[model samples]
Target: MSAVYDTRRQSIALSIVVPIFNEEEALPALAERLRPILDGCGEPYEVLAVDDGSTDRTPRLLEDLRTAWDQLRIVTLRRNSGHQAALTAGLHRSRGAYVISIDADLQDPPEVIPDMLTLARADGLDIVYGIRVDRSTDTGFKRRTAAVYYWLMRRLAGSFVPAQAGDFRLLSRPVVETLKTLPDQQQIYRLLIPSLGFPSGRITYQRAERVAGTTKYPVHKMVLLAFDSITSFSAAPLRLATAMGAFSLVVCLAFLVWALTVYATGRTLPGWTSLIITVLFFGAVQLFCLGMLGEYVARIYTAVQARPTYGVARDTDEEQQ
Candidate 1:
């Protein structure tokens, strides 16, 4: 009774990839909501629950849920390779005409998926995004920061990542295949998706609070995710760093010329104050450029190694095979 049966003969129309990380508390509720919507869609679909090395009972819960649903499949990563890596793993493993990715925390509702699919079909879009309409549940600081981040990303990245759109979205088989061919270690799925240049649409919905489980994406992790998204997609930061260094150098040289001219003209004396200021400013600029260059170089080094994005600790599909 292998779950990994060849689907060429009987084409699977849909697959839902739910990346779980320590979501033990929300498993039952998630299943209860998802199963009915998936079943009612009238398209053959499978749910791939990617367990991103949960330390809690999330793995055990996924096993039990798989037993309850015939189309449910599980992929367990060896360790926490991160949310984006886990998502990429699930996308690669899925076999369906269309694939939808969502959070296991139940914040993204499964009920809206049918609408997304319908819109995709009607509009001939390769991808459909779920955009959050309301962030009332989030803190004011978080809400404002998210707004600022999205605005900056749109302006700087040269990619129109829709405001308030998360990883919860649907992709056609062609889009999924195209996505699989991308080979980057530091993946930013949201940013990369738009670069495909496929016809896309968005569905707006209010984002609800997590049904259960502790929030896995804390402030620090959120900041890192933002950095990863920006750095992975656009060279704008690196380019800005270069421009800044050039500007600083020019300013320093201009000041030196002015100071030397003043000395020559007997207008002022060469003193520590001006020299100290110039030194400090140049030193800060150099450090900033070094940091920016290091970020890009680190990403290149990671890609050169070509390590698999994630490892599988235990797979229900593997056992069935």
Candidate 2:
């Protein structure tokens, strides 16, 4: 499974796309662990470090590392366009037969690359998902929320959406091209790729802790990611909203029946508590439905704009010329 790659080959066999934000603390260690694995593989590869408008020393560190390692390519974005956009940029730019997207945080082990490559080639798989078998390294809250997320996604996006699979995965050329063709304004590759119904395989790995730097994905970002995942992949959320509205209507009807009974029996209360509660409940239900509709509407609006998700400020490969 471990073979020497021919550097003289004109075509690149593999491309490792790493989405970096402020990963200055992790870059060196990432290269240390990642380069050896790539070098040992029997395919000529390039590591694409996408700088998502880092406000820290991440860009400078990437440049320094690239200076020493020619295989390291830097794709600097004009602004921080978020994780998914950074990934979209790298996937579009990567010119390899197979591309693997990973994070610079070193949580998803680089040691699994050869195995992923071997499995994909052996089985002729278009996608190889790196599933986290043990998430004990993650906080309890993180793990629980992640479990719920996968559960909802699988139920909504279909059971084919693998549980515990994040963005760490290998995509063959065909899969990469197919992803490129998608017109999604906000791409959630986790669901988007699996929905393609491509022949795929999964490799389980123990999830590790971040090597350095604060986590870019806080609670808010996780919520947003979940929102995007639900909206972009399935119309289930909208359906859920409709169901809630129907339930609210039923409740309102029941309340109306009760009020009529009270009025006919001459036992109607003068207190405003019941009226205020009813108003608040109905208002809350309406707002919830509207929010769900707004999410889809916002996506439609962005799609109509047809704006690029990310802009490349600089490319080391081009700069070399």
lDDT of 2 at 26: 92
Candidate 1 regions off by >4 Å?
A: 1-10, 265-270
lDDT of 2 by residue, 113-189 (tens): 99999999999999999999999999999999999999999988899999999999999999999888888456898
Q: Candidate 2 — which pairs collide?
A: none
Q: Which residue pairs in candidate 1 collide?
A: 78-311
Please report the TM-score between candidate 1 and the true structure: 0.92
Q: Identify the candidate with maximal lDDT.
A: 2
lDDT of 1 by residue, 8-39 (tens): 21588898999889898999999999999988
lDDT (C-alpha) at residue 211 in model 1: 96
Worst 10 residues of 1 by lDDT: 1-10
User: Alpha carbon lDDT of residue 57, candidate 1?
Assistant: 93
Off by over 4 Å in 2: 1-9
